[model samples]
Target chain A: MNFLEEVILKEGQALSDQVLKVDSFLNHQIDPQVMQKVGQEFARLYRSEGITKVLTIESSGIAPSVMAGLELGVPVVFARKRKSLTQNGDLLTAKVYSFTKEEENEISVSKKWLKAGEKVLVIDDFLAHGEAALGLANLVEEAGAEVAGFGIVIEKSFQSGREKLLKKGYRVESLARVASLSNGSITFTRNGQEAWSL
Target chain B: MNFLEEVILKEGQALSDQVLKVDSFLNHQIDPQVMQKVGQEFARLYRSEGITKVLTIESSGIAPSVMAGLELGVPVVFARKRKSLTQNGDLLTAKVYSFTKEEENEISVSKKWLKAGEKVLVIDDFLAHGEAALGLANLVEEAGAEVAGFGIVIEKSFQSGREKLLKKGYRVESLARVASLSNGSITFTRNGQEAWSL
Candidate 1:
């Protein structure tokens, strides 16, 4: 978490009051070594829950999910936003409302990919409004699977995402939680039990 | 390669005359162990080529790119299809035509993440019409970077993707190349010297 926080501080760019662009190492352009460490950290954190699959959305979440999947020796399944010709009709679909994109898009996963009673851990790059996570959780539940927990790389604690997921009684773990991004400065919540100190 | 071939034969579904769906393990739901082997194979194949970065386009390409990046110990940069609110204006953009979706979309990579003169190896899940690869290659070139090679999980030999890439003088390596898909039977091109025998 320290490494991730350091990387965010060093490479993440701020684009106004709400957006922090981590294209350098976290999302668009990825640092594999750092990603591997993050994966190992997630695996260490959630290894005891008996996670059967790692679920994520398309694009940004694929890298970390793949990394965590490798460490956990589980399969990684991603929900596709766009329906391609290769995609079949046998799918579990969920409608995700993106606050940023300002649109509601249907994301789906093949029912053949997710079993009926598997334990799934959801992973993603950023947890802002928690819409994507909730959507993914919906897909998992649609398959009659259990939500073991949620793992995120960077989280905006000031947002309602954490509160929303916690309201649903889902255990969420994030590597770096930004307590506040006031005046273009990032303040990360102290990880571990010290998170209570914030 | 044998493992990948076997996976394709077992789990891959023939959606139509041209589309082969391997979402069970290659794209939608990925087998981490097999993905690690794929990364290792890519690393072994391109280790001597001095690859500085792994380049790919999201969302399907992110898995194999991360795998290959883990093996090569290099960073992975994925081109995003749409401009998100989090993305900044500093980007290298290109137009890509999606045959499956039947649409044309713009893919972009942040300028801050990709540097000039980096040796990049492009990776993807499928090589059908080669538009995505060509779009990624265009982005790399726009960044003033050199493409070391292209690695694909599966390539439909019946399609013109390989020929188009070969015409561009790119060294392409596909783990499983389907010669033809007829009556739900798949034929793989022999490895080694016979691969080019086509």
Candidate 2:
């Protein structure tokens, strides 16, 4: 299995039947080496997309966004989660819901950073609900930029996040995808160990 | 004068007499190229300190912490600012007062990531009020770890944050120190232009 898939299987905790807590390494307690490699993998995956920038939200997504930006050699712009944003120039905004926090927030980006015709790669840690990625994609579209694709660290495929995104005709790639979480056992989509090793 | 100092002098804005907004490159909107250089400088400064890990708070500090971790080739752990953290083992927490946000938050780190006797290099984006850095240092200490030093991207030297950290006998280094902010002009600690070119 790839290092990321292996790490998730070995270190990720299945809390209850609905949650996969990877805070020990992927999100809360970060392993920079592993995160950097994740970025490199994303960069390799999106190398031909002609991505001009990497975009994400604050907090958890910052590390992976920075690493991917460094690997892609592009500036990274993160949308700040705010209660509200006054209508202003050069600002693109959208509403997003946080499944983990169970709260909705307004995410926005300035017009100066994201320009017309620029291709953006959205990088985020989790894809449970896909609201965050969708919000960011909306922001890019509002800025008149094209979303090259999305790079997510972990995707809960049991949820409709990926299917929704795919139905909308957006390209989405995830490093480690969980197909099902039954009782305490977690099943990954890419089950074969070799699927991860390469 | 350092490269970061130069960029601050050129791009940093003085919103009020007490605030120097560096959203153009540091926090809100990040310049990865510049941040990578800042990390290199910090890595060079603390090369002999025998630092085992890098520590910082979440949100703004994540990018710089990750970059610094990459340069130092160490793991980076961030403290999460929550209204409360359920008292539990495998967690080291501290109370930090935010002068800007006008609130107090309980920041915690997983004990699994920080170990007793390990030297930690604290990296942050700013040193305003020093509470964040000091709070992170407290987390390290609570984990029974040692603080190697603090590497800050910007220090509001006009405030008491740096002074407070210094009084505690902590080795604190800042890439850009704002000596004074009068009207709309900012005077950097490194006054000469050559200070930045170096």
Docking tier of model 1: it is medium
Off by over 4 Å in 1: A82-89, A191-198, B82-89, B191-198
lDDT of 2 by residue, A47-110 (tens): 8889999998888888888888888988899898876677777678899987877788899888
Report the C-alpha lDDT of model 1 over B6-67, residue by residue, as the tens digit.
88888888877787888778777888787877788888889999999998888777777888
In candidate 2, what are the lDDT values of residues B102-176, reduced to their tens digit?
A: 988999988888899999999888898888888999988888899998999888889998989989999988888
Q: Which pairs clash in the backbone of model 1?
A: none
Candidate 2 reaches a DockQ of: 0.71
TM-score of chain B of each: 0.92, 0.93
Model 1, backbone clash pairs (residues 3+ apart or across chains), number:
0
True contacts kept of each: 0.93, 0.78
Against the reference, the lDDT scores of all candidates come to 0.84, 0.85
